[model samples]
Target: MLKALRCNSLERCFQRVTSLAEARQALAEPQTILWLDLFNPSQEELQDVGAAFHLHPLAVEDASHKHQRPKIEEYDSFYLLVFYTVQAEPSPERLRVCELSIFLGERYLITVHSEPIPELEETEQRWTRNVRQLEGGVIVLLYSLLDTIVDQYFPVLDAMVEQAEALEDRLFSGELRQRSFTQDLLALKKRFLTLRRIAGPERDVLNVLTNRDNPLFNEHALLYFRDVYDHIMRVADTVDLYRDQLSSTMDANLSIVSNDLNKTMRTLTAASIVLVVDALLAGIWGMNFEYMPELHWTYGYALALTVMAVISLLLLLIFRRLR
Candidate 1:
């Protein structure tokens, strides 16, 4: 879907532009700014918007493709930025990330995404609430979008922290008998890895937006971008920290499992030893000897049984003390 919001100094409020023709006309208005948003657009829609805006082929291609790295590229008349919006999926093991491609021109900003980004919606509402400050230029609007995206990471990180804590608790509580425990732990690690991959480059992207000599970004906008850069840095650091913690947690869990297995083996060995002693006594008594003392004397059979029971009890006590 395609949507457009047009803002101008004279208008004092955002005006809806319904069609590409209207957007093009609005672009000609003095001191005007335009935002075009496309969500889950088809190939034809992308081509139409790309052609209408005379967007660079590479930028348009990047928008069509999924899994583009987070970065910003300077085109002739605009900048193409690729970033991701992340949310934890219903399954705690997986992260849901949506790639958003933005074309930031002097007077317009066009955003394309295959999936819905709640940040964009929230940014729009924010702009509506603070139009006096954000509506002055597209740069400010872009700042708001970036700010929203960066802020969204914290909640996901918080959820991951809670999940990691829960897993750690479960690990210590002897729930390792569950078959899926290790798999879940590994999945959480993967999610953190993915978060790092996304946030690290995003920090660089923000760095470029703040430090690059781009005419589109004014001093005020650069400051806002710097603030966002700082936020992304924190996110990257958090990812790294959690990844290490999870690794340690996994190692501890492995050690616990090994210790438990060793205890089981020791128990089995003790049982085997007691049974072997009883078998040895029975074997000696069962020997075929016509002159054997146990066969000749009536009390000999009772004495052999008593000896076996006493040896077995001694072995059991020794093993119990050793354990």
Candidate 2:
């Protein structure tokens, strides 16, 4: 389906079921400034649309596949933007990710995705309910979409921050090691790495502002793009910080466990030595039961007990000194 939303009016302004003929006609719009979305199209349909827009064959191929890394490609006439969306992880899972590809040109923007993401609907709703409240230009509208994606990055970061603090606390307090928590931290780090791969390419797409010759954003829109750039910067910084925190937390967890294990081993070593000495004494007495010298002594039992107690006390003191 092809849906066109006029930025100025902020309504589902003109949604046409675009056929090959209609798409060819759409290119002829004289003064329409609109956002067009095409979702879950078949391969033939993608090819038809691609042919209509003269898209890079490679870009169309990537769009048809299920797993294209998030990226941005600047073609002669428009920009091809590959981005991701998050869906609630089903049943027991925590989250699911989907990709979105956008073709942005001077007069209209085209979005393509395999799934109908709620974020797009939400974007549309915002455009519809609060149309006039928005800044009207294409870059501003683009910013809104980028802004939504970037903003979603925050909650992910925030959740990781909370997990980091929790892990830090557990490490300090010498609690049982949390292998799963470390795994979660690592998983989050990996996910953020994927995000980096996607967002990094976008820097090239949005880098238009720094160079005034680019047509994406005008002088008046540079600051808005700059603001979005700052947001992207913060997210990049946060990804790095969280990765560092995860590594540190894992190290701390390992250190705490090793310390606990070493302490346990030391105590067990002291006990083992003491047990050996006691066993030797008992064995000697037991074997020479035919009137052994120490066994025949009147106070032998008491003396043996006293000797064992002193040895135990001295061993404990030596261990304490070493510690």
Candidate 3:
């Protein structure tokens, strides 16, 4: 989808442009310094856009396909920047990531995405809901959009920390075994690692802009991006802490399982000892000794059975005391 936002002269109005002619028309307008967009152009659309703007072939390819890492390339005429954005569906509990390729021209900015981002809707709402006009300049809009996406990381990381802390409490409570809670912790650990893998590199990407000798920001809007970068750092640190907490949680679980197994082995060993005593008495009675005078006595059977019962009871009492 192609979206154009014009904030140059008076009120802010958004336009949807599908064709190259319309895009070029928006780019040609002196007032149209900002363009927020998503493009999944086909073969024809790609060529048309490339020819219209004199876009480099590599930039177009990078925009079309997914890239392994975030990057920024300074073309002779324009700047090609590849950025990553994450979408967390807090309701459905799903996470989706995509790359955003931005073309920053002298007067206009173009953004391309492999998939749609709800940040577009959010940006619109921020503009429409407020009575105050957006301040600074075109850079404000650009920086605000980036800032919005980056700022979302805080709540996500914070939520993960809360969950980790809760599980840590449950881990020692001796109640985690009843609720499939251990499995839940493992799943959370996986998600934490996933979050870290994305956040770390993306933080580094933003850090470049923060440390840039001549940043890609206007003097007034620079502070906002710097603040956004700081939030990114907070997220990285939180994820790392969560990762460590998870390792400890796993170790605690293993210790509990081992303790349970030891209890089971002790019970089995006590039963085996009783069985050995009974087997010895039975073997002596079955022996074919011809001079066994007690075998002829009618009370012999009763006496032997009574002796076995007493011995078994005595062993049981001893085992109970040992336990």
Query: How would you order the candidates by lDDT, starting with the best?
Result: 1, 3, 2
Best of the two (1, 2) by lDDT: 1
Give the alpha carbon lDDT tens digit for every residue of 1-323 in model 1. Answer: 88999887556678898988899899998788899999899988888888888898888989999999999999888899999999988887788999999999888999999887889989888876776775458887888888998899999999998888888899888565465888889988999999999999998899888888766777877778889999999999989988998999899988888899999999999999999999998998899987876587778878988998999899999999988
- In model 2, the runs with Cα more than 4 Å from the true position are 6-20, 87-94, 126-140, 178-180, 208-212, 286-306, 317-323
Candidate 1 regions with alpha-carbon error over 4 angstroms: 134-136, 173-177, 289-293
C-alpha RMSD for every candidate: 2.0, 3.7, 3.3
lDDT of 2 by residue, 1-323 (tens): 66656543333254544355665565576544567677788888788778877788888887888777666667788777777765334432144677888777776667888777777876766555654534444565666677677667667656656756766776678556767766765666666666566556555555654454666666776776777777777767776787787777777777777988999999899889878877776677668466557667888888887887888788778878887
Clashes of 1: 0
Please give, for residues 3-51, the per-residue lDDT of candidate 3 as tens digits. Answer: 5665443455555555557778777776665564756656566656667
Comparing 1 and 2 on TM-score, the stronger one: 1
By summed lDDT, which 10 consecutive residues of candidate 1 come out lowest?
127-136
TM-scores for every candidate against the unseen true structure: 0.92, 0.81, 0.83
- Worst ten in a row by lDDT for model 2: 86-95
Candidate 2 TM-score over all chains jointly: 0.81
Residue pairs with backbone overlap in model 1: none
